[model samples]
Target chain A: DAGVTQSPTHLIKTRGQQVTLRCSPKSGHDTVSWYQQALGQGPQFIFQYYEEEERQRGNFPDRFSGHQFPNYSSELNVNALLLGDSALYLCASSWGAGTNTEAFFGQGTRLTVV
Target chain B: GENVGLHLPTLSVQEGDNSIINCAYSNSASDYFIWYKQESGKGPQFIIDIRSNMDKRQGQRVTVLLNKTVKHLSLQIAATQPGDSAVYFCAENPNNQAGTALIFGKGTTLSVSS
Candidate 1:
């Protein structure tokens, strides 16, 4: 089965620009989560969408938001981006939103803020 | 393959040797732990996972050990090969978070030399 997929393998945007990244969950999966990975760090949780609603969020600010479609595809939107917002955006999908569920990840969208 | 981190904690191991990557999680209530391998340019791939109820779990060429006593988790790769060179990360699912997001550790880079 096709695994999780993300759009725009790489993106470049200037400060204050708004960018949108898209993700398709793995076949048969329902829950989608977004993560931000800096150059030397592990992926940090951004937020998670389940049943088309944002169920949980990390310490990120209002500038970072997301939407999940009925088909299980999701979008991560960053408004008024800053240089610090540059990172690899990873999308992970799982069969359910539960502690025991394992997640499958997408290749990720590399966002470069100039 | 994935892009290499700007600076990684590298583990240089000889072929056929065993390599271990360790991670310490902050949430004591984390119920699931996972190990992911990310090659240069690609997304993180699931290696193995272990649940809180179990102290250890084994996969084809990898084993995951969870030490709840110390909130520590580790990934052990057997008979390390050059193809096994990649960054390994451990992720934990904190308890009762509606998002079911994973908190990741700073990754450990593994370099297998033949």
Candidate 2:
């Protein structure tokens, strides 16, 4: 079975521009979460989606938003990107929205804000 | 405020030597903890996890120890190899509820020299 997959492995965006990253969760998984990782740092949570609804969000601003499709795929949108927004966007998938469940991560989409 | 931090930023060990990485978390309500390893140009990969109820959990060659009393967590790698060179992060679910986002540490870089 294929694992979690993310689109546009690498991307470049200018300041004040918008960018959209896509993610296809692992087979048989339902929950999707997004994270941002700067160079040489661990990932910081962005938000999580379950059952086509956003269930949890991190400290990110309104500029960061996400959507989950019925097929468990997800999309992360960042509006008005800034230089600090340049980082690796990681998508994680879990079997269920349950405590102690394992979340598998995708290779991530590298976004460069110019 | 919730935060997870590592005791060390970098660790170098000779091949076949065991390695230990430590992390401290600020959220007392966190119940689930996970360890992830990420290589250059890649996303975090789950190594092992332990819940607050359990003090220790062993996997193939890795062990995760969780001390809820002190809000501390640790990962032990047996007979480390060159392939094990990567950045290690400890993540915790701040809230015990399902669908909550995970708080990750800055990460500890492990370099296993052959």
Q: Best TM-score goes to which candidate?
A: 2
For residues A3-112, write the lDDT of model 2, one tens digit per residue.
Answer: 99999999999999999999999999999999999887788899999999998888999999999999999999999999999999999999777655899999999999
lDDT of 1 by residue, A1-114 (tens): 899999999999999999999999999999999999998778989999999999999889999999999999999999999999999999999987864587999999999999
B-chain TM-scores per prediction: 0.90, 0.95
* Error of model 2, residue B36, in angstroms: 0.3
Q: What is the C-alpha RMSD of each candidate to the true structure, in Å?
A: 3.8, 1.1
Docking class of 2: medium
- Considering just the first chain, candidate 1 attains a TM-score of 0.98
- Please give, for residues B1-114, the per-residue lDDT of candidate 1 as tens digits: 221121237899999999888777767777887889999888899999888999988999899898889777878899999999998888877776576888787788999988
Please give the TM-score that candidate 1 achieves against the real structure.
0.94
Model 2 preserves the real interface contacts to a fraction of 0.73
Q: List, residue by residue over B1-114, the lDDT tens digit for candidate 2.
A: 439999999999999999999999998988888999999988889999888889999998899988888888999999999999999999988764757588898999999999
Clashing pairs in 1: B1-B40, B1-B41, B1-B42, B2-B39, B2-B40, B2-B41, B2-B42, B3-B41
> What are the clash counts of all predictions, listed in order?
8, 0
In candidate 1 the C-alpha lDDT for residue B76 amounts to: 85
Instruction: Give the TM-score of chain A in candidate 2.
Output: 0.98
| Shift of residue A86 alpha carbon in model 2, Å | 0.4
